[model samples]
Structures are given as C-alpha cells and as structure tokens.
Target: MAGLKKKMTIPFARVPVAINEQKYVQEVLESGWLTTASKAAALEKKFARVVQAKYACAVNSGTAALHLGLEALGVKPGDRVFVPSMTFTASAEIIRYLQADPVFLDTEYGTNLITPGILEEAIALHPDVRFLIVVHYGGQAAPMVSDENQAGILEICNKYGIKVLEDAAHAFPARLGERMVGSLGDVTCFSFYANKPLTTGEGGMLTTRNKEIYDRVKKMRLHGIDHDVWDRFTENKPSWEYDVVEAGYKYNMPDVNAAIGLAQLEMAAEFRAERQRAAMFYYEHLGQLQEFMDLPVTRVPFSDHAWHLFPVVLKEKAPLGRNEFIKKMAMAGIGTSVHYKPLHRMTYYKNRYHLDAKSFPRAEKTWQGNVSLPIFPYMTPEELNYICKTIEKLLKY
Candidate 1:
C-alpha cells in the first residue's frame, strides 16, 4: 500500500483561469467602463454562439438567471412549479420568490436527475403545474427530449401550457442529441460561478430561442431599463436619457467578471476535455470499489456529460458511514462535498412544504450517502492517484 501523504490539500474545485483572462480584465479596467458594457456584451454574444442559442443574456449569478427566466416565462404568484428535490436550493427558491409554490419531484435512480416517469407522476398528482425547472444533475443532461414517447418534457409542457426552464448550472457545454442544453428548453440558465464548469468570479447566462423572452430579460436584467446603460456613454452622441420599463433587479454581470467569462468561454472546449479526462480516471479506478461505493453515471442516453462533478455514493456495506468517510478523507488533506442534501430534506423547505424523508425515497437515500470528490480540469494525475489510493486505504479502515 502507498503511504499516506503527511500533508497535502486537494480542493473540491479551483476555478479555471485562462492566460487571456487577465488581459481582457485589464483592458476593461483601463477602459474605465466597469458595468455591464463591451466585455459583458461580447460574452453574451460569444456564449450564445457557443451554446447555439438565438439569444443570451448575461446575469450576475445562476440564481439571477433562473429568477429572470421564471419571470419571463410568465410565472405568477400562486403558480405551481415542478422542481427536483435533489437540486440546489436556488432551483426551487426562485419559485418562492414569485410567491409561487414548488411541487418537488424525486430523482431517477441512476442518473439522479428528474426523469420523464417522475415528471409524468408529478403531473398526475399536480395537474395544475404551470412551470417546470429541470436541473441537469451532476453535469449530466437530463432527458429533456425523450425517445420513449414523442412528447418530451418540453412537448408535454407545451401541450398543457406549462413553460419549461432548464437550470443548467452544472451542465454548461452539455448536450442532448446534437442540441446543447442552453437551447434545449424555453430558457436555459448556466452558472459561471467559481466552482462551475466555467467561472467569471460570479456570473451566469440565460439562453433562449424566443425573441420576446430575450428582449424582456435584457430589459429587466438591469432595473428594467428601456436601453442598455452602456449605450448612453458608448454612443457617439452620448445620450444620457433612458426609461425604466418595469421594476427589475440589479442583476447585470460586470465588465470585469464578463471579461473573465469571455476568456473562459473561449477555452471551454479545452476545459471540458480536461474535466472529462479526470472523470474517466475516477470511473476507471473507482469501479473496483463497487461493493463499497456507487460511482456516478458517466454516460447518459442521447446526451453528453459535461463532467462538472464526480459524486460517489457509499453503499450500506461500506466500512465507514458517509460522514465518517468524509472525515477520513479530510484527515488526509483531501476535500470533499455533498452536491446537495435534497431540498425537501432542508429545514426551510421541509417544514414549509410538509415534506418528510418518505416524500422522496431515492433522493433521501442518495443524500445520505452522497460525497463529491475533486474533479477540476487542472487536477494533476498525482492528485487523482492520491485520491483513489486514499479511498482504497480508507475503505480498509
């Protein structure tokens, strides 16, 4: 057995920063246009092209993108939105922000994403569902389009006048049968947070094919202004006049952040390849521990994974409990995280929605055993080997 490292620290994620990231940011700083200006606009254009979406709007965070997308989808107070309980709180919290209610759905066993069967069941139970937020869990694209039936999630939702919004926080560059996630639904939200596949310090983007939604999001993203703030200063005539079309939030991505995003977007393909390599490394090595742990699904039907996270689930037969295993890894200077704790299991959501563990059997069980290992694009081979060997050693203890 390889000896444990006396001291080392592998972070859960180290945000990817490209060589040009600093150059673009420096240009933005010297230009003195700090708000959502040229770089932000450039990022929006570049991201839309990359994701094959007709329109893209950059926002301050993934949560902002969801909130704005929901508002544009015509989600109203008291409306019922179907959301997966296994996602981060941001996915469902937006429903509450609009004074609407969330009908939490359980995840599919293998993919850990909300499947069509579960969606159908939720529809059967809550026929009044007007909106749905499908999160591509663990960077694996959820089956938005189905082969089982002609009517996929979008088609079914359209049939009943239910709008679909995709929370693609973990699924940037992920695809479903030639269609990228950003173009898969009515409006798809992508996170550019430090830990996501792409990072802009703190930013996100909303993509869509609907021109109306795009226009609304653009106007509403920055305090409902009729014209972009940049237009006032950047124009040859320098017009300062503008109108607030409606009450909106301050959710515009700054030039500095967007500069970083533009660089990140440019290097997305390379970053994805590296991350995928890391995922493959884990998959190949972790298979030997199947009796002790269950690894994430690397492949999904009709979809390509972005490999943003590598989550492992400890089985009942494991030598250590989930928490115990995490502690042991920490002692070896390795960091780990739980992708989620199932929103329904959280105190705020559970108490408010009258949810119990029994409400979502799969998600509850998955939560109990879930542990996310480091799988960033920059992770070294030595780091990967150390992680795997450490797990092997921990299992024996």
Candidate 2:
C-alpha cells in the first residue's frame, strides 16, 4: 500500500488552462471592442462546426441557454416538462422559469440518467407533456436515438410529439456512437462553467438545426434585440436603431469570456483524452472494490464520455457511510463532493409537488451513497494513486 502523504490537497476539480487562453484574451483586450463582438461570433461559428450543428448561439451560462432554448421551443405557461430527478437544479429550474411544471422521473441506477423506458412511462401517465429536458448526466450521452432492437428517447419522444432539449452541460465533446451530443437533440445546451469539461469562466452555448429556433434564440438572448451588438456596431447602419422584438433576458456571452472559450474549444479533444486517462486509472486501481462500492456506469465507451465526474456509490457493506468517507478523504487531503441531492428531495420541489421518496427508488438509492471524487485533465500519476489508495484504505474493512 502507498503511504498516505499528509497535507497533499487534491481539489475535486481544477480547470486546465490551455496554451492559447491567455493569448486570445490578450488579443480581445487589445481589440478595444470587448462586449459580444468578433471573438464571440468566432466562438459561435467554431463551436457549431465542431458539434456538427447548423447554428450555435453563445450565452452567459448554461441556465441562460436552457431558458432561451425552452422559450424558442414554445414552452409556455402551465406546460409540463419531463426532467430527471438526479441532476443539478438548473435542469428543472429552467422549466419553472417558463412557468411550467417539471415531472421528475427516476434515473437508471448506476448511470443516474433517465432512460428511454422511463421517458415512455412518464409520457404514458402525462399524455399532455410536449417538452422534455434530457440531461447528459456526468458527461455520458443519454440514449437519444433508437437502435435495431430498442427505441431510444428521441424515437419515443418523436412518437408522442415531445420537443427534446438536451442539457449537455457536462457533455461537451461527447459522442453517442458516431454523432456528438450537440447535434443529437432538438436543441442542445453546453456549460462552460469553471469546473466543467470546457470553461470560459462563466459561459454557455445553445445549438440547433432548425432555422426558426436558431433565429428565435439568437434574437432573444440579448434582450430581444433584432440586431446584435456586433452587427449594430460593425454595419454601416445606425448602432442605436435596433428593435426589441419581445421582452427577453440579458444572456449574451461577452467577448472576454468568448475569448477564453475559443482557446478552450481548441484543446477540448486533448482535455477529454486526459480525463479519460484519469478515469482508466481509477477503474484499474479501484475495480477490486466493486463489492463495497459502485463506480459510475456508462453505456458508451469511456473515450466517448466527457469524463466530467467519477462518482462512486458506497455499498451497504462498506466500512463507512458516504459522509464519513468524504470527511476521511478530506482529512487525507483529497477533496470530494456530492453531484446532487436530487430535485425530488429538495424542499421547494417536495413541498410544491408533494414528492415522495418512494417515487424515486433508483435516485434515492444512488443519492445515499453518491460521492464524486477528484477527476480532471492532466492529473498526475501520484495524485491518481493517492486517491485510489485512500479509497481502498477507507473501504477495505
């Protein structure tokens, strides 16, 4: 066994800055026009090309992207949307933003992802549901299209006329078979939050093939202004003469943040590869402890996954509970976190919808033991070894 080194702190996540991040930001700084200009436009073009989408709109956050995408998809007041019980608050909260209700569904046990069967069952109960927000949980793409033997979420939703909005917040640069996530759903949203697979400090993107949806989101992202700042400023027309098509939110990504995004986008493939390396290390080191804990499960190859998180669910027979295990790991200088407590268990959702623990059996079970360990790009062998050894010591009774 490797000796546990004292005071060697490993954060749950660390953004790996790309070589061009500084250079691009410097160029943006020198350009004088910094707010939502050429850099942001460049990012949108490059991002769309990379994801194989017809159009891409860069926004300030993933939540903003969701809000805009839902609005564009005609999600109106009193509508019901299907969301997974095991995701960040942003997934369900966006539904509420449109004055719509979320019908939270239980996820698959190990993946914490809402499967095609779950979606079909929910649709059976709520036949009026026309919208669905499919979260690509922890960087694994949910089964969107049907296969030879079974119908997928997209196939099932299409039958019921459900508009699918993919929350690809943790799944940038991920693929489902040959198609990347951004191009798979009706509208796809990606987060560039500090700790995500790609980071622009605080930024996001929305991509879609429908020209109407694309135009709606593009106009609405910046206070419903028909003309973007770049267009107004660059064109020969008057910069001040823009029309407000509708009352919209201010969710445009700035040139500075977009500058960062450009650099990060360039290194996205490299970053994903490094993350996969770390995941492989964890599997090799901790595979023996499967009896005591459950590691993340994915249907696709590990290389296809974004590898944003490597969570483990401690079994009933483990030496310690989830909280205790986290504390011990912290004491050993390793940082850990819980991906979520599930929206069904949250006080607001529970009180509003009268949710019951029995309603979400898989999510409930997974939540009890969920602990997301440190996984990031460029993690050293020593760091990986320390994390694995610590888990072994804690779990091996």
Candidate 3:
C-alpha cells in the first residue's frame, strides 16, 4: 500500500522505429498497385524465407493470422483447444471464432508457455482436447515439447486428430533447435503491429511447413478464394474468374502494408540486434535488483530472442506491491504494464469457461506482479540507464 518514492515520465512504446521502413513506404506509394497484390506477395515470400517456414501468408493483424491458422488447421465449433492463461486474449479469442472453447492452461512463473507436465495431465483428463495453443509470452520460446511429451500430446491429439498451433506473436525470430519460431510448432504466427519487432503499422503472418495447412490458410487469408486474387487478374487472366472455395474473413495484408513489412524485414538483423542489446542492458542492470525483481528465463540455448518486451516480475519487497509499483513508475514518468490479466480471470472467459481466478496460481501471481518495462529497438542506452536508476531510487521506500 505504498507509492513510488517520487515522479518522472517514460514512454511504453513508440511506433515504426525500424531502419528501412519509411523508404519502403515511399517506394510503395509509387508502386501503383496497392492492396493485397504484388508487394504483399513478395513480402510473403521474403517472410517465409526469413522465418524458414515452407509457406507464409500475410494478414491484417496477429489476431487475424491466428484466426486463419485455426480455421485452416481444422478448428471446428465443438473443438476444445488448450491455451495458456498468461497470454494476450488474442491467443484465446480466435478459438471463439470457431465456436470452439478454450481450455485455459496455467503458465510457469518464469515464462509464459503452458507446462509440459500440466499439459500431459490436461490431455489425460480431457479426452476432447482437439488442439494445443502455446504462446511464448513476450518473445520467449515455448518450453520444448519433448519427444515423449510430443508423442503423448500428439498421440492423444492424433488419436482424435488434434493439431498444435503456436502463438508466436512475440517470439518472431526466436529459435528452437535448428528451426526458427515460425517453423517450430505445427503452425506459428507473427505480428507486425506498430509496436512489434517489425512493424507494418498493422499486419501479421501465419507460417507452416504442412502443405495442406499452408495452402488452406493462404486461401483463408483472403476471401477463401481458390486462387490468389493478385494472380486472378494478372496479364491475360479474366477478372471475373474466381471461386469462393469456402467463406472466409477479409484478413489479407495489403501491398502497401507489405511494402512496409518488406522494408522492416530487410532490416530484421539490425532490428533484432538492437532489441537484444536493449534486453541485455536491462537484464544486466535489472538482474542485480534480484532483491526486487525476477527476469524471464530463456530456454533457447543459442536461440535468438526477438526481445519484444522486457517483462520483469517484482519479488516481494519493502512497502510496494505490483499495481502500486506500476502506479509509482507512471508517476515518475516511466511507463509500465502487466503483460496480461490471465485470460481465464476475464469476465467473458470466466463466465463462459467457468474459470476461477485461483485456478492458475503461477500465472495469477505472475500477472499480478509482472511489469513489462520499456525495451525497444529505438530506446537510447541513456534512457535505459535512466529507467534503472529511476527504479533504483524508487525502491528506497
């Protein structure tokens, strides 16, 4: 029940900081064809190549990418998908699109993905689980789905035929083994919002190695058109010849947005370097504050972190709780936020799923105290130091 010992103001996130984004937008302005056409196609190819996915389909938002991924992977109205309680609602919300239910799985205190043990337990108990949705919260990789566990989960899912979808919205360039995030799970998703590692203002991509899933998602990303709309009118093709294979949402990413994404993607290396640098600075500096906070643990041995957000958990300390600490930081001009209130605890999810607040102790405690401090590619080192110093001064009582 205490406050930040004083006042200061720091931003949480600022948009479009990628090095080559602006020039790309200008080039797109002159490219003539705009909407989900040429630029979008090229971006999809570049995105697939970079992420190492056999196929990639650009869409309007991370949520759209998720929805399309689910649809293509055969999510149905009566299906039950196991999802982490600790992720953004977008991860769970897509399940509702299929009239399917999200069976909220708890997260470990140190990272966002659902536990392999609890997942095994859940799979055993719920024979109806048709899919597993793993969210690598704040750019951290999902805990490995070991061969044994994979066989277990996949066996059960395969018995009833279930698919695994990974919500990699934050874990963009993260790796697992020799594969990148987008290629890790059955289908993985990435975001390009104004605030992501790569920003297209508002866009996302869904990736998969499975030909059927990828092809279907590609169609679903558009209006479920049997073929690419851009190709439908290309050269000598008749404009009126197209088929609505199956009704789908208008989630396609436009060429202009792809133009921005193309530019941002080109600079992914530099962008990734800076974000990791910012995280390392935060980790090196903030890790010393163990008396006050806990840093997220990385599972990837040589896995590259996209370092999307530097979420630190405040340990039990003198005179301050999580919410109070956030208020104090805000008062001091340092912007901060809790990554999420566990999805199960939200009114709609609770009412629908009958999810009790106390069901996920780890995720609950994590959400209650987790503070995502400002970490971005554009943040100056001095700014980061100022934040650490500011928090240091504040913890004094």
lDDT of each: 0.87, 0.92, 0.79
Clash totals in order: 0, 0, 6
Task: Name model 1 segments beyond 4 Å from true.
Answer: 1-7, 148-151, 234-238, 299-303
User: lDDT per residue, candidate 1, 84-179, as tens digits?
Assistant: 999899999999999999989999765788877788888889887888999998888887786755457777777778789999999988888889
Which candidate's TM-score is highest? Answer: 2
**Which scores greater on TM-score, model 1 or model 2?**
2
Q: Model 2: per-residue lDDT, tens digit, 292-346? A: 9999998999888999999889999887899998888988999999988999999
Error of 2 at 201 (Å): 0.3
Model 3, position 304, has a per-residue lDDT of 73
Error of 2 at 142 (Å): 0.2
What does candidate 3 score on TM?
0.92
**What TM-score does each of the candidates earn?**
0.96, 0.98, 0.92
Deviation of model 2 at 155, angstroms: 0.7
Relative to the unseen true structure, what is the C-alpha lDDT of residue 258 in candidate 2, on a scale of 0 to 100? 97
> After superposing candidate 3, which stretches have Cα over 4 Å from the reference?
1-9, 145-161
Deviation of model 3 at 20, angstroms: 3.3
> Residue 215 deviation, candidate 3, in Å?
2.1
Candidate 3 lDDT for residue 306? 78
Clashing pairs in 2: none
